[model samples]
Target chain A: MSAKPIPGTPVFTGAYAMRGYALNKMCYSLNAAANRAAFLADEDGYCAQYGLTPPQRAAIAARNVAQLIEAGGNVYYLAKFAGIFGLNVQDLGAQQTGVSVDEFKAKLKAHAIHNDAVKAGRLANV
Target chain B: MSNIIGSVATSHIPAIGNAIHKGLQKDEYWQPFFDGFPPARAWLHAAKPDVAVVVYNDHGLNFFLDKMPTFAVGAAPVYTSEDEGWGIPTVPPVRGAPELSWAIIEQAVADEFDVTTCQEMLVDHACTVPLQLMWPEGWEGIRIVPIAINTVQHPLPSAKRCLAFGQSIGRAIRAFAQTLNVVVISTGGLSHQLEGERAGFLNPEFDDLCLNALINKPELLTRYSAHEIVELAGSQGAEILNWIVGRGILGGAAREVVRNYHIPISNTAAALQVLEPA
Candidate 1:
């Protein structure tokens, strides 16, 4: 709980939990296959049923991760929403980072340099 | 008296479930991650645990913002995996050791942990993926007792508290009248963010510190607040709280039997470690 928050990594604290409760609850319903179909059948209706705020509904309609988070949507719950769109974490990462999916993927793949170095025995067991 | 055999900590990524469903254990992309398991499997098999005390955080599956429990213990006769929105095939129901589960619940509460006790809990990938990896033959042989920690919603249990809670669980296991062997498995994270502009953020250095600290100096990890953990390990990487509990359940000093760290497994820096008491 610092004045300067961890950049870009929004912690889903109690405030955010209370703020996003309705929105997250809708997403949580997506855990059941029937609920996923119900949402897809009528996205606006589902949002209304969940009593989502205008911003949360808008974020859901736009399929924007940043806007959703700004509207108090937790990433784990948002992931269920994202899954309805056939998007995985990599796709969400690409969308949020404003990069091509491949570029976002490359960024993740790039971290393997350390793995390579470690494998080469250049780094001791971590 | 019941025994604390060891602990296994691994990534419970949903992608791994899909890979398992597709028979991709040896696929080029998954080989490295899958390769990390055999040794752990060998050690775990040799340990012959009758019950596995799984410590993992539910990822919006069973518990939601409606009533999130910082720590929930499963006291059900069986724990089932349901659809997690990804359509990843659900693993078979995990047999539950209600007797052991209730014992841990009593002990954890006595130790002032105040954990939620669920008589019927639907476990998600956090429980299934790692359990599937450990018991690919199916969950018929060994029973399980799940402990779900809230790593999703913040005001998460601090590193120190989770480690302490885990030690209390260790005591519960040790005091049980059964002479059963037990293995504690904690799932998720090294470092890799899955949300926001820092979606692909990673910290191999922080992971290196943790992987070593789990074996050498877990108190070094307790010094951090949850926010500090998110800053160092990505938001999702805060799942290491699950790992700290796993380490603590080892009761004290333990020997690292095997360890593996790999990156980019669906926006995660996956790490697995199998340890036994020194």
Candidate 2:
């Protein structure tokens, strides 16, 4: 059942959950508008309130999905944190890949051609 | 006696909720994906089901990492939607069927499934979006019993495990004393990742294989472990586990009524498939 890991795809494992619990809790709290506003009003205080680790705090400060992930933040939760600044999944993807928002979107849109191939039954079997 | 009429599976991407809210179904970017629902909708109209058993994952809305349940069932009289901190439009509260929920929970527990039962549950886009798409006028038309799977955490239930769980749920539904016609609806995945450098990743071939195997040879998919599925299908793409469970619930012979696949729906290979038992 073991398989080589996919590069750049960090599966949110137990270790990550254990490490990112605080960071994720903070992000999960943003589901409430009040919590989101509270975090916005005092970013540093919010992190402290959640007891974010130094690395987790740095990742949040960096606004880097990769770093946040490395610090144990799952994207589902991290997405709430991203929402604070109007960053969607594309923006997060672009940030993680070091590409512009347009470029990231283009990357996703380009899959349409591949989908057409599959629809046409021209795609090779897996 | 209660019976499963069929199963409908689709990608429950958050953007879809926004699109439906903004009346963007005809927008060029969304048309193709939105168009795929008509056939499935038509079939649903013809085969009216009284209740929907929705299988989906909670994206940090109902459960947090601290008390993450591998399998959870909604036992509330009603379920509400949350914005999930992203300002996505929330749908009206969907009615929940506690009797069916308790039946499935009792059966699952008796069968050693160890599923968590929630008296008060908040469903996320995964559960809400599909219901909205299926019943555009309103979700109030159908009562729902949501089965939330743990797809966010790494130690997710194996594909085989989800299949078995679905089968257990099917038995519970069929054995219910009430004469309820239920439809099993599941949301998530064809193949698109939204994490790390592989964000927006799509695998058309793998997606095609999954779509085909889901109908003909679902067991072929159980060979891939959860980690392996993440490697091949992307972290979020593993949401196909929901599909696997739906297919298992269908259990015996079934035919694919309709299927729609489109790429790049908010970082997902959006797919809609309807299957009816033979």
Candidate 3:
């Protein structure tokens, strides 16, 4: 609600919701198995059917989370797009973090170990 | 009069469902996780509530981004599980307590909560995963009243509001004249972010704080803003809102009967807690 936003995170506010409506709707369509196949067969045509903006279409083509976010794509909906490419949420997270999937996974494992050590009082600050 | 018996909160990770479906409960990788659920299973069997009011959020399943409902309740007689894009082995349809569902809807609306009532709804991992973990025997004779909350997109309901919604649901259940016991189960989150540059983030410290607060100091948790939750826990950690709802259903205070927290369950920290009215 404030002019000072939450820094880096793209808050999916009313404005973002409105801007990404078409893009989100397209992503939503991937819930159905048939819809996923259809999109894979004709990506551009599917985007067009959803009335996606050029930027959104470009973002879809690029498979970039940042671009999709800028084009008003919510991460939850964007997950469907990622799934179509055999990328799970973690894969998408890796892309968003500018790291390779293996690196991202390793970080997760390290974080868990670090947290466990901290809980056991072996480590102080994590 | 119908009574609110108890509540259970657990992380409904999709991987948990897959592991269970693949019969990997005894496997080394999943053995530790499965070890935590025996107490929960025993408790469920002992309590034997006639109906369970399950609070879970759909992940692009029933309601897509086209029209995401902040709060949706299923009033259908039977609810089936969705395929969730990839082919998840289909489970038997869970029977729904439509009469109780309608009663909750009517009372919730009167309580000034805008709730979407669905005649037909599909349950996804959010609902099925937890069900699989909590009640592995399956949902053949068991009855469930599914309440879907929104934690997918931002601008989600505040922790305080979600708690209030749970309280309202408790009241509605009490108002019903059914001579049956009820259990409230809320699924999702300990701490894991699925999006942004801060992906794969986990905070056991914050999660412990949350589990403690839910048992002894739930009022303390309501102060946490969505931004603070994301900053401390992770984006998907917002699903803790569902847990808050579970706590609120028990009203003032409840004793934590069971608590389990395990980390790195597919890029997220998974937790399970059961509370009984004190």
lDDT of 3 at B192: 87
Worst 10 residues of 3 chain B by lDDT: B82-91
For residues A41-107, could you state the per-residue lDDT of candidate 1 as single tens digits?
9887878999998888888889889999988998888888898878999999999999999999899
TM-score of chain A of each: 0.89, 0.90, 0.85
A22 Cα displacement, candidate 2 (Å): 0.9
Per-residue CA lDDT of model 2 for A10-126, tens digit only, reads 878888789888999999999999999998899999899999999999999989889999999999888898988998998989988999999998988887887666654456453
**iRMS for model 1?**
2.5
- 1 versus 2: better DockQ goes to: 2
Q: In terms of TM-score, how similar is model 2 to the real structure?
A: 0.97
True lDDT of residue B252, candidate 2 = 88
| Candidate 3: segments with Cα more than 4 A from true spot | A114-126
Cα error, residue B246 of model 1, in Å, equals: 0.9
lDDT head-to-head 1 vs 2, winner: 2
Give the better candidate number (2 or 3) by DockQ: 2
Candidate 1 per-residue lDDT over residues B135-201, each given as its tens digit = 9887799999999998887788899999999889999999998999999999988787888878899
TM-score, A chain, model 3? 0.85
**lDDT of predicted model 1:** 0.88
